[model samples]
Target: MKKLRMICLVSTFLLGLPMLHAQKKNTQVELEVQQPATGLDKSLKRKVAIARFSNETLYGKGIFYDRDHDPMAKQALDILSNKLASTGKFILLERSDLDKILDENDNSNSRFKGTGADYIIVGSITEFGRKNIGDANLISRTKTQIAEAAVSLRLIDVSTGQIIYSEEAKGEAELKSKSTLGVGASADFDISLSDKAISAAISKLVENVINNCMDRPWRAYFLTVDDGNLFVTGGKSQGLAIGQEFIVKEKGKVVKNPQTGLNMELPGKEAGRIKITFTGGDNPESEFSIVEFIQGEIDHSKLENYYIEEIKI
Candidate 1:
């Protein structure tokens, strides 16, 4: 009887090997490939920061879902940050120090001092959970699970305190399993559907972000002027390619708002146009490029007050 029991155990183990292998293969997660930046991508390059996402869904609040340990909001933020970095279209800033940086900037007397982020992205996870959609039978039981993820994102102009863009994206993944008699197959929740759903949502968000940035004009500042060459605040990272044209304008007058008593900038007259002659450094953080006079000449005396704006072709 012992020998017969051992034989049955060995048979069961052999029969389970194929099922295990198949399950492993099906659970293999596939990540999206990063793509190279195009001309449009370079033009829209800006300094950006991602704030920790808020959890607004009932699942995150532990209402319908029992799995309270899952950090759905944090996972969404991480995925979005990765997607934005891979695009090479934005200089990403650390979120942990964002509040401190903003505070310092606010209290500083210098206008240019402190960490500068042209835009800040804030998000909220609205839905994240799994639903069991399968049925059971007398001979065989079938189990189907569908994981869903959804996020709402807002792109805010840090300097203006305005929401430039807002979008929502959702993704879903399905997993199906079946069992006959005592032998069965099932996929883990993490690998089978949850991860895929998050990735899909991130992909959609990235597309919308890129499209919105493209609609805006590119702007930069003149860092220095020497020997008739203008050192601008942008380089290849900002899409300032060789022979690109930019309009240089002297800083305009500061006008005070009557209601708020806040200072605002008036539109400045066109100083001149400059063409990119040499691009220096590849680092996006300190990107700089040299420019030569293309149309009108810049007044060297007013170089400190000049700013540059790209002229779109």
Candidate 2:
């Protein structure tokens, strides 16, 4: 009798454990769901441009396919552009936008080049194909529609004209349907599958894009300083906040490499430090900042000779 009683007690405890855990989980989920999303969070916004996204494969082309307006290429480009923008880490530009920015900058201030995309992503859809596979038995048949896509990408630094990152990725999508006695569902040629396949391929590379673009050190250039007021090329649109300190460094001389036939700039030494006082602009491409000297000073007359970097921890 005692053993049965003990068994009943153990079963009750075991059952009660799940109840306690469930109650705790419900409270935790409620707390998590109550948290709101704020769009004003401080996030890095680097300048990036989509140089080109070409479709090299013959998968979606026919006699009527226009080389200049390849739908496949356009689809891939749109997918990649949207994915990169969704991260909120880049100010995207097209080839046409570059000229407009340069012109506007030249008009606004000769010193500030405005915001040009330092990084450009070049991509190609290398391969794409779709097929239907069918399996049959005595009384039942099954069909599966499959799509496969492959893409190659290169992230280039516009200033250095160098490929900073390169990668290739592939994606696939499948849909299966089974019919018994010819009484099942059937699907037409779904173009959505191609979009999905391409999206999947680009999604795999977005992280690499963000990481390589950010790996390069952030640098702000001196635009102009007048009567103790200093202005830099970046503003709040590019993540500059008031009271943030940055170390200033003199511009290093550029030298041509004898072996590679390439011109490279030597590392600049620290000159001084400055703190941001104001950041204002109507748009990211026209942004500017006012700063006050905190430590050290640069040749204000030769603004092109100095640049700013984040203070080291």
Candidate 3:
């Protein structure tokens, strides 16, 4: 009877152990989630433009057919752009706008010279292979899939016509599932496999590029308004620094894009200096900042009367 009682106690303890451990682990995870991101120091922004992916080489070997669109290259570019933008330290020009600049360059009749883009990103990809791996004990019958993607990007400085940033990355993902499971396995596994790995590599590249340009004076604007505060709604995470001062310039009349027939806005006039009191959180929509200093009294009248003139020498 004593042995049975002891056994019952031991069984109950063993069963409860997992619950205690699970609770502890969950608490730890919650604490970690609540922790703020480290490295909150000022991050500098770069004026970067990314070009579309160009296919450099194709990979396939054997009697099997290999003919399909490789979507990951462009997908990777888009993801990289978003990740870079997320850092809040970049003036990212849209890919379409960059293409427009390129188009203008290729045109002989166009009078619009390049805006002297600081850095241009060009990339190419090579798809290596696709294979499956799992429960492959049946060396011959096991359907194994392995895919490899290689990417290379160049950051060209328009001023010097030099490649300031160059990086290359390659990744392989494996899909191992029952043949009956169909194509969903490929899509699902790739997303899970690549999101973590590819994003990390590109994040490092972006950080490196920004670090290289940390000392350069990036573009910034300032303002003084009667509202007592100015919103910094859009900026690369590294674009604006805490305590950095800006000279507010009023934006002028609207302009039209001749090719796409789009309306573009320009800065009209210089107002006064405004200093950044604090930085923001991650997302642009979620960014919150305060205007700590304004030089002059600004109201709707000042805004209406503002007109920018070229700085006299």
Q: Which candidate is the best by TM-score?
A: 2
lDDT of each: 0.71, 0.79, 0.54
What does candidate 2's lDDT look like per residue over 167-258, in tens digits? 99999988888888888887777878899898889889889889888766766777887787998977776788777777899878887778
lDDT of 3 by residue, 112-179 (tens): 22533456777666444445555533332234556566667777655334466788877665555443
**Residue ranges of candidate 3 with Cα displaced over 4 Å:** 1-41, 59-70, 95-97, 100-113, 134-144, 177-204, 215-313
Per residue, candidate 1 scores C-alpha lDDT tens digits across 150-185 of 878888665445567998899888888888885789
Q: Give the C-alpha lDDT of model 2.
A: 0.79
TM-scores of the candidates are 0.66, 0.77, 0.44
**Cα-lDDT of candidate 1:** 0.71
Poorly placed runs, candidate 1 (over 4 Å): 1-44, 56-71, 100-114, 182-184, 226-229, 250-269, 297-306
Query: Which portions of model 2 show Cα errors greater than 4 Å?
Result: 1-42, 97-115
CA lDDT, candidate 3, residue 92: 66
lDDT (Cα) of model 3: 0.54
Candidate 3: C-alpha RMSD to true structure equals 15.0
lDDT of 1 at 76: 73
Clash count, one per candidate: 0, 0, 24
